[model samples]
Target: MSRTAEEIGRTELGPRPLPPLGEQRVASDLSTVDTVLSNGLRVIAVHQPAVPMVELRLKIPFAGTDPMHAARAEVLAATLLTGTDRRDRIAVDTELALVGSDLDATVDPERLSISGNALASGFDTVLDVLADALTGAAHRAEEVNRERDRLVERITVARSQPGTIAREALQRHRYGDHPFTREMPQASDVATVTADEVRALHRASVLPRGSVLVVVGDIDLDRALAQIESAMAGWSAEASAVELPALPEVVGGDLLLVPRPGAVQSQLRMSAQAIPRTDPRYPALQLANLAFGGFFSSRLVENIREAKGYTYHARSSLEFTPSGATLLLDTDTASAVTAGALLEIRYELGRLGLAPPNESEVDTVRQYAIGSLLIATSSQTGLASQLAALAPLGLGVDWLTEHPARLAAVTTEEIAEAALEFFAPARFTGVIVGDADQLSALRGLGGVLMP
Candidate 1:
């Protein structure tokens, strides 16, 4: 009554061969103006007319080591556009809506980001509102009070989440007491933040020097540049925005098993230092990571998730910062299979280095990488985001336009070397959070430390 997949494929012209991926297309160069405003803001404007909308991404380095910095930063971001001298919260929202625009502001340990999009015809209106808020945001007492309360509630709930628990454990294990580890402020800290503190932090940290603004869409480069310069003339700071201190190099050793009293599953997070995008070997490393665990069909995902059912998914990716980069591998599994999953991950790491990707494997990942880049840049917002991300590293459209060729040039031999150097099991350190009683299997695994 039923036939197995193997049996069904056997009669279908002997197991169907997968179709070959189509040839990759190179992305065109963007006409861009990369300039520094008189007030010290780095502005990158690109004319990408794929659509009638313009996208804006403003990145301001907002790092700080003070005990209250994270809480105040959170509160400030939440209330940034709530009001200014010329307009109140409702007025700001109404004007943006009239121009078919939407904007949002968020902060992390390293930076404050303002991202938005608007109809190209309303570009000047969008810039006007952004400039108004940057120079004159009031951070009114009522607004700050409301957002601070909300932040506390959100942080309280977030702390109880397993993923949050795992992330905190991993960050602590990697860098003890580093400000970067302060991904989210404690609820108690947020509850104590005041409007005056928020305003003071804004004046001191929300600066222009060393910050970047990326504008991309169907707009003239010269006109956009002039508009941005005129709009932001009054938003100036004598001091540069703060930069997060360099992260301590993650030394390779045993995976730390962080105890969670009644957890049902284990969250595994591991990291090791790696080269930056500027390195010539980065393309090879990218391919190696993808083939190992960065994609669904990779060795780790196939072995642990598809074949063994140890976890739903596994990912190995490169995390970049202006200072450097690191390779991070993440997955979650039932406590019963945590050890097996770690073993498979390490085994695959070793296998990738020793066996190397063959020509066929390299070709598949190469195509995927090239195709992914093309698709990502196929949109105005995507292009703007990409440029914004690269701006901090002093790269721009040239690097993006030339990346496909670089990836195409990476060889299997190079990828294998990258895999060996960067993904070695001994070079990785991490945390596994789960019930102490259930993860006893990891003790005998020899690589992980049990609490």
Candidate 2:
């Protein structure tokens, strides 16, 4: 059935009414057990019941200052579960297979994380295996050598990437030689890490004190807590895990030009200070960030990508670091257009602070913020990961459940104020990674430091 042309023509044609936003559904006040054990590990257990499986995240404060710490930490993560006094690699893999479970470990500048999932009934086996490795990992020489080779290959490849180069430049430009700046260790450093060094680092830094373990799934909260306590009983030390030293504040100034000769493209990365999720004003700032560049509909994307075709993508978001929350904006463009892109980016930043978002824009971003959080915490793994991230910041399920209401209560005026104070162009500094020869136009634009 189709309307006649005359009938269609007679109807007033205007924008269709935007659909009403769906109800902002937040997580229920589920029963949770959050407490510290005798060994000083904070354990948080919750029941999601979405499936008969459990998700686990163990985070240990693994920060260090030794120049070689990053290399040894990487090797330790790679070979942590390969063998222990009680079991070898083959036996560990066999038991895990029988339990329908898998485990993986990784390290960054701040912590060592071991993440795993298993069928609810087989969760005990998973924990037992984790306990075995925590107490008795051998860090066998062969296993160490194998993992070290892989790290070398990955490091070599990563160092050659433009994104990695830009990240290193921005990190150094902001934090200097801080341990937090070493997101990736140098390949040369990794090659020298011996099994003995990894074993030593493990003994010194893998203590359960100040660490956290999170479990979410279909299980009795009490039973899960008991099991974690029993499994992690042997993993303790008198000394607490080392925490990273606080980072210096990021101050605003001229952008550094990091020259990469003959490069066909350039990367621009910028940062400014921002409030955390725990702050009362954070809800408003979240919406302001989205309206600025956090989504496809943001002002930054609309101007630089949709209208001017300066870059393929542009993004801005809040990043939580050990120091505190910071706002990061990034984009890449052809070398010839890098200067123009930076100019437009700065113009949009100034406009965001001066003009701010109107009510309609604020409403759209509010809906987005609410919906995204709901989606992020909808599944067991999602909730587990969220809890893991928030635990370090002293936030938990209450914060998760009450966030929607906070987002709903922020007004357009609050959004305007947040935008004005936090999005000012003068409050940022960063680095530009590109061929210096193609970036002369940036000299006239004026916040850029010519190479």
Say which candidate scores most in lDDT: 2
Ten contiguous residues with the weakest lDDT in model 1 = 8-17
Q: After superposition, how far is residue 229 of candidate 1 from its true place, in Å?
A: 0.7
Per-model TM-score, in order, reads 0.96, 0.96
* Residues 301-348, model 2: lDDT tens digits: 999899999899999999898857899999999998998899988898
Error of 1 at 257 (Å): 1.0
Q: List the residue pairs that clash in candidate 2.
A: none
* Residue-pair clash count for candidate 2: 0
Clash totals for all candidate models:
0, 0
**Clash pairs (backbone) in predicted model 1:** none
